[model samples]
Target: MSSLDKRGLKERLTAGENVLVAEGYLFEFERRGYLKAGAFVPEVVLKHPDLVRSLHEEFVHAGSDVVLAFTYYGHREKMRLIGKEDLLEPLNVGALRIAREVADKTGTLMAGNICNTTIFQRGDKEAVAKTRAMFKEQIEWAVQEGADFIVAETFSELGEAKVALEAIKEYGKGLPAVVTLAPQATDKTYDGVPMGEACRQLEEGGADVVGLNCHRGPKTILPLMTEVRRACKGPIACLPVPYRTFEECATMQSLKDPITGRREFPVDLPAHLCSRTEIGEFARACRAMGVQYAGLCCGNSSHFMRVLAEGYGRSPPSSKYSPDMSQHYVFGSDPSFKKYYQEGLIETVSLNNKV
Candidate 1:
């Protein structure tokens, strides 16, 4: 069995291997009430290092190939929101330390994670710079603390993603950067960029791996991955939010304004999420469609990650045609059934049974 290491993950994929990447600790912690809102990084690492390591170990026990640090939104800016800005360095750096502990234990690759600086100003250079700074600090800490790769995820716009990619290149120094976007269920980003076009832009911006994550469930994102598989040349990842199918919610959020094109709150979301078997099926289908990195987004659980890991790279079960279905043609059960006849069956008139 080949142990996981992020630095060589792309090479392995290029050599025709399907890698299983699992990321889900924050939501798990939150669901358990160990983590309050806006304090995942600090609470998990500083206060409850055992919980962080325990979650990582759960993924390892379940067969995840990567230990993505629960450093999502661990920058100083987000810390300031919850009045924990003073804990920024300890939170960010300490998260990486916790990640390393797990990666070392399980021999999994540690992926440095950063997402959504909350500065999505497209044309404003100052705003973009601030976003870069936010990512830069986290990327620097991850690199210094020895992460194998970087994942910039849940981005809703190409412009903000570009800024993140630039920071990864600047600070990570050749570490593979996987940029994942959160497009609406309509297959376009909330900022109005088509999913395919956004993947292309991230590729051009120097992201080593490009794919979709968060927002939509795997069932709804399947067609979107099919669309992206055409535009993206090499390996791609597809880690969807662990929600039930998007049939309940047409999109991840409410309608956007006609003028500003924004929906502040997500009014529609599934009360229950996908089952372990369904997530496994999702991983299987993504592998068939050429998605190399298969994982879960928010609401991720150890059981679901195990489902994905169990099915990664395995061929889906061959389709079956029901024997009864074939009998329909011969027995004249089908209105247009004319291909064959059943020897013992009688095709008769209604009154006299004359055929």
Candidate 2:
């Protein structure tokens, strides 16, 4: 089986064939030392080939029409963070190869995952420019390596999203591109740019689809989607993070609460985790709100995605209690490094050569 051509992707999106399901932890590589940064070890691809393959098959079995490859942090900068810059291309190519292999086996469409840049700050023109170049180079490589389309996920800043879109336009060679933003609790970016503005900017910058991802949770993103639909005409996608439970928040606060009486203060839990039921509901809402695509983000696993697929045409699930820890990990330390170096494994996995 071959990858979907541009015409095929355009037809799929236009025909309302959206609703992608993410297979979480597929791209998570083991790290070395306890605190030392680790590399994007090849073992993730080797040891988890069946895991990746099964995930693609499962999402397809669950009725999801699209599957995203495991290439979230596959870029050079992100790889450098884990001391695996040399493995960037191999990691990215392996991800696409695995996705394609699974798609060929299951007949599901695949979207190459080209996530946001490592940097989140805005106003750094030089850095942004360099990032755009990197994005362009990466997208070109993905296309050459055989990606059906591209999805740029977890973008918190519109400028970064714009730069990514610009890169796609320059190197996408007309491949379909979907852009997803990570809005703040106020339904805006960290820089205060409204979600609607960000959507519009991405659409203007040549994205086929513009939407939200990795935000607070389904409930918070629901309201934000309304604002985005109002301002943008392109297709939209919503991939919310899992909501936090009350006890989880309390436990966290107990651990981090420095002030003696701070724990006594009312902690209004921010809506975070969207259960399978809620995810399904959100997916339906997205379809109603003119969003052509919907999926899950951080802390969301294949099981959540399965439920999302099952709830494709239903009302959104009720909002559960969640915490407001969205900003806590904005610059948090990397945790996957410990497993990588501990194993001393670095064997590359080859594609099945069916593509």
TM-score of each: 0.81, 0.72
Candidate 2 residue-wise lDDT, 250-322, digit = tens: 2211222334434421122122334556666766776667666777765555557656755565221111212
Candidate 1 residue pairs that clash: none
- Please list the C-alpha lDDT of all candidates, in the order they appear: 0.76, 0.63
- lDDT, candidate 2, residue 89? 79
List candidate 1 segments past 4 Å from native. Answer: 1-7, 38-42, 251-270, 313-355
| Number of colliding residue pairs in each model | 0, 13
Q: How many backbone clashes does candidate 1 have?
A: 0
Show the lowest summed lDDT stretch of 10 residues, model 1. Answer: 314-323
